[model samples]
Target chain A: MKVPNILKKTVPVAVGLVVLGYLTLYFVINQTPQWIPENLTRLARQADLLENPEAKRCFECHKEIYAAWKKSRHAIAWVSETYIEDSENRSKEKCLPCHIPRQVKNGEKPQPRLDHRDDGIYCVPCHVIDGKMHGPYDLFSPPHPTQKNLQYRESKFCGSCHEKTFEEWKIAGVEDTCQSCHMARTESRLVQKPVLSWLHSKKQVGDHSFPHGEITQEDLAVTGEISGKEFIVTLLNQKIPHRVPTADNGDPRLYLYVRFLDDSGQEVDRFKEILAPQQDTALLYGKEARFQYPLTAPVRKVEISLQYKPAWSKDKSEWRQLSYPVTGDSG
Target chain B: MRTSLINSLLFTLMLFLIPLQLQAKDMVVKAPPESLGKYYPPESKEPKWIQQMHKMSGNLGGVFVNLREKDWDNLDKNADQFVESYKEASEMVPEWEEYFDLKAAKEFAAAAKTHDGEKIGKAVGAVGKTCGKCHADNSISVWTRFHWPSFHKIKITDPIEEKELDFGKYMGLLSGTFKGVTVNFKEGQYDRSQKALRAFKSRFMELKSTCSKCHTTDDVKLFYVGENVAQAFDGLQKELTAEKPNPGNFWKNVGILGKQGCKNCHLTHRSYAMIQERWEEK
Candidate 1:
């Protein structure tokens, strides 16, 4: 173990100079007039003082996720007229808890937000909690502290609010969760910030849109046959895991509309059967609902269509319709 | 010296057996096989599994009754039927074959013919022990899985607003209105109290309409959601208006609603409905 004398003296001198230079730069940068570019990401200017940032603040970095969330039913949970009226203008304490909910934890219903009543079920309540941002990832972000929480990837996390649907899902006895269906995953960088996001590689991120995975004619299958003086049409809810037109507090509807035309192709009779959950009238998961309408007139053709109105929707035009062509003629 | 040698041998035997007992005890309880669903509904046209179970129990009961009456001819028939059903059942579900003890059945038959009470009892007990072992592990899982109909799937119509609500929300409204009657009356808001009572009455009565959703049989609908509950609600309305109303009258109606309407129905329905959601065939 022979020591090199020249190395020791030069090493100390270089280290001293480096320290002195760093001190000078730190003093100069903090004290002097600095012209930072206006286009610099918010990562550079962390001057926003609100302890709890709005969902819009997240838009600066998470533009796509922010946009999707803004368009979600959760965004209008607080401001929706239906919610307002149902809650008796927020006078009902029981109804207000879920609308402007605080942080969600696994299996526990969230408490009402104390500070941000207008935000609804927004970003801060879901992702931000306990002075740090939480997600289903273990990654670095200099702007804020991060903690990995696996509950974000589970159905029980959403069970905090969508309790009834969650229970229905559990009874379905399927492994696929609320998140698995609704917040489907895609590969992309979670952040849109310039240099900060570049440090991270592309990874699986959930779609925050919370899409219901729109039901269509593909979901509800209609088949029929005319038996003498009777027309029997069966609507099978083939693909959906839950009852069609389902809701917790709201009355969503499914209309099985039947139109019959005479031998001359003039409309003869029309029949409408409305179905809803908890009433046993709704189309069940993987089950068939049979409707038999009598052919009173000299029959010709049969037209069958399934229409759905979500609980939140008000206008009839907003109701979604799925129609099947009436090919055969009774005449 | 002979006694000491025997004691040591027994100690060695006990030592060897303890770990074996612990290993058996530590086996985790899992749901019965998904293959059981093969003989159940949505798979088979008839419930072959339940039919097999019923057949076995019926023959076993016949064997007991015939043995008690000392009817040798029918005893032989019932015993033969029991063994036939037992063997058939063993072949029905492969996973359950381990629980079916044919040796125990033969032993019971041999004992039953001997015409000794103690021997017959022991033999029957042994055969029953086989069933008990199988049932102890599987009966609740099977009952929870197959017997209960899903009640939570349906919605309730709120008669006051003429709107349909989810099960949980409807329950909340039901509870809220019931409490409202009490709270409004306490606050001296007689008008609000009367309004709440009216809403409560309508909601209570509207609950009857939902019974037909599940109960097609008039008897089933009549049992809980029938005339008695309807009378209870009506009695509460009249009691509230009485000149000297009993303070306990409201709670009496509450008790009737709680016992017959909520508690009894929940006992019959809720536990299985919830457990079915949790239990898995895996």
Candidate 2:
């Protein structure tokens, strides 16, 4: 079984090619930074380091993890609409301590300094191993090295700030938790039943990312009309407390003044109720605040106005109003 | 031809397998019903917020009986049990049910259970606190002119008594860091709203009594309902002011008196009979 001349020549060429590839790869590998840099992993592992200069350095290495954290609710917790509504000092220490845990926890200079006020939820505190905490919280350092426990992965971690919702749940006897409601098993269409009909459409195929983002007024068409005079408007309450164009307490409630202005801008008579009840016992899910308004006259334009104020404002005209037109025709 | 067919089959297989793998990973991380407690502190020691909230709820219980119950001491003795029960409901119960907090309501019940005057006062205080917190988070504020007209035009009209709008009596009670923008009214015309909101910033701090605590801040922006009605009322009032210019008539039309809009009744009105008759169901 002697090898053919061509085959022998090809084998040597292949070996030579393989050797050259190995040498190239070796040089490339040596030049690259270490995959698990000691200090980087160390900072990520320790909650204290995560709060210190080490955390910023760790981000230099673990860019992906840091990005995920920056986008999270924890990083920007203080700056959140709900938190800002709670107090005047949107950048105050009381709020920042829980939101930007690293600032207070690490005792970084500038005393109560937050590296990223915009980053809602800090990451390393939540994800680091050995970052053990007693309850939903533990103010003092744990006796052992800190670790990210599976417990933090649970809804109770979120419940620390969401006390009202947690209590309502426990009292009501609902078994479902936040994680069950928010996280997904598949990147399927988020609709409870898939709209298979969309597949037949001329549009490109669905990517099925369970589309979650702020849906502007433009995206929401007057999908269904009660009558030609009445239209259903799906407006997003991007803020957590579920009010459009939110403002401070007890001053002015949000009023969706839906006026069917004729060709001339005159208010038409119509049946109007408060869009949704303040004690919104009606457990409607999703971000959209669905409102139905009936117009008195033939409406050329349906205007949706969201005015925010408390019941006892010092002045009426001072109330803030944010009015936007729904894209599609209501009539 | 065979290779092409196999390649086609493999493409379909890859798409199917990839989605399946992604789906499996997603299931592991998917969110649970928000009602389920994600993580509980092993021992159920309520936070400062919860404790303060309980004390307030007890105050509400007392409010129903004695309109002028002071401090949270009455709450601990009378309403503590009711607040404790509701606290359990709010902290422990997991769904929205009929009278969900009713069964666990201890403040009001504690008063009934004990039949003590001071105990009843405490129970009411706790309940009031809960209402205050809920209203604080959820309601909004609106200002309406309730002052008597400087000039009277009509004769033989049903006249209402003059009430004080003096900021002095309510100096400590109503002074709060109001997170609202102040609008300049120039000879009855609305001017531009400024960038920085001029809060009655120190209002909440001055509010020592339950009435001041609950009614001082406006949650008008937070109300889930009555936007249309409120606007209509506002527009109608403006129209009436231009046309009628009579304070008594406008007050009659709005069905309210005093500076505060709805809080005028809800906070100031004590008798249950009057509250039922005057106020519409929220």
lDDT scores of the candidates, listed in order: 0.68, 0.36
Residue-wise C-alpha lDDT for candidate 2, range A171-289, written one tens digit per residue:
54445554444332323321111222221112211221212233254433223334555566554432233233221122123334555666666665432223222223122223555
Taking every candidate in turn, the Cα RMSD to the unseen true structure, in Å, is 23.7, 25.8
All candidates: TM-score of chain A:
0.76, 0.40
DockQ (CA atoms), all models: 0.01, 0.02
TM-score of 1: 0.46
TM-score of each: 0.46, 0.32
Residue lDDT tens for model 1, B1-282: 544543443344334323333434544445568889877654653468889989887876665566556677887777778888988988888988898899988887777667554566667766776676777667767776655554454466576665778766887898899888878766656556656877776576555545544453446756776677777777766666666556577668767876777777778877676665456322
Worst 10 residues of 1 chain B by lDDT: B12-21
Alpha carbon lDDT of residue A72, candidate 2? 51
Q: Give the TM-score of candidate 2.
A: 0.32
